[model samples]
Target: MVFWLVAVGCLFVGEASSSDNKITAKSIRVVMDNNYPPYAFLDAKGNLQGILIDQWRLWEQKTGIKAAISGIDWGEA
Candidate 1:
């Protein structure tokens, strides 16, 4: 009975330690101007595509996170 209890305790401790080593995904939100040219701008069809957007895409790909841009007037930003 003592051996069984020790074995169960060791198993629980190992599981707990493994769980502690697990990684968690980070949640992030970035707000940017989708109208600023060169840095960030909308395409002819009003799609967000620019230098900054490209950089953001690279960042998202590296970090395995989703990125998005919303259009807001200059004054609101």
Candidate 2:
């Protein structure tokens, strides 16, 4: 499900480290289809809102690593 996908994505993110095996990046960018309801989509105010969005926000709070989540068209994904 979406949870597993997000988990796997987080794993890959950690793999993008430097030669000393350290993650030098201060933030991470995540792009997904904006049309997927309940998982990812825009709200009435044109703001990103969904279960996945909330999850990422929580991840940011827990890890202190900013997650720049963006929603794009399915075709663009």
Candidate 3:
């Protein structure tokens, strides 16, 4: 899937560019549109939610990397 591809690509790029070919960063930043609904959005409680949010959480657990996921207005994005 596209998500997996992008995640892997990021890892690859990180490794490829590092002096020791390793992922040196402890975290990654991800931004998404807050109004996209099911894919990504702010819930009634004003928290990030939806499929992308879930996937990113899982990715964080699996990769052991903190993902600072945030959302902004689509137009601003």
Candidate 4:
């Protein structure tokens, strides 16, 4: 009985380890106007830099989520 219990435990551990190896790609893309201020905009160097970017970076770090920013025209987006 003890040997059977040990074998079952081993099987469960093996299954758990294998299940943890699965990889999934999940991300969120954010589009905002490059001309807008505070909400979203680009800096002098032509990089997306603003309050929203800082907020999103913190959110991504805390939630383990990937994020990307793209420039869009105000009329289009």
Ranking by TM-score: 3, 2, 4, 1
Most accurate candidate by TM-score: 3
Model 1 poorest 10 in a row by lDDT: 22-31
| Better candidate number, 1 or 4, judged by TM-score | 4
TM-score of 3: 0.72
Per-model TM values vs. the true structure: 0.58, 0.69, 0.72, 0.62
lDDT of each: 0.78, 0.89, 0.91, 0.84
Q: Any residue pairs clashing in model 3, and if so which?
A: none
Residue 70, model 3, lDDT: 86
Q: List, in order, the clash count of every candidate structure.
A: 0, 0, 0, 0
Residues 1-77, candidate 3, lDDT per residue (tens digit)? 99999999999899877756568789999999988889998878999999999999999999999999989998887
**Which prediction has more favorable TM-score, 3 or 4?**
3
Worst 10 residues of 2 by lDDT: 15-24
Lowest lDDT block of 10, candidate 4: 20-29
Backbone clashes in model 4, listed as residue pairs: none
Number of the predicted model whose lDDT against the real structure is largest: 3
lDDT of 1 by residue, 5-68 (tens): 9999999999988987744656466677778888888888988777888898899889887776
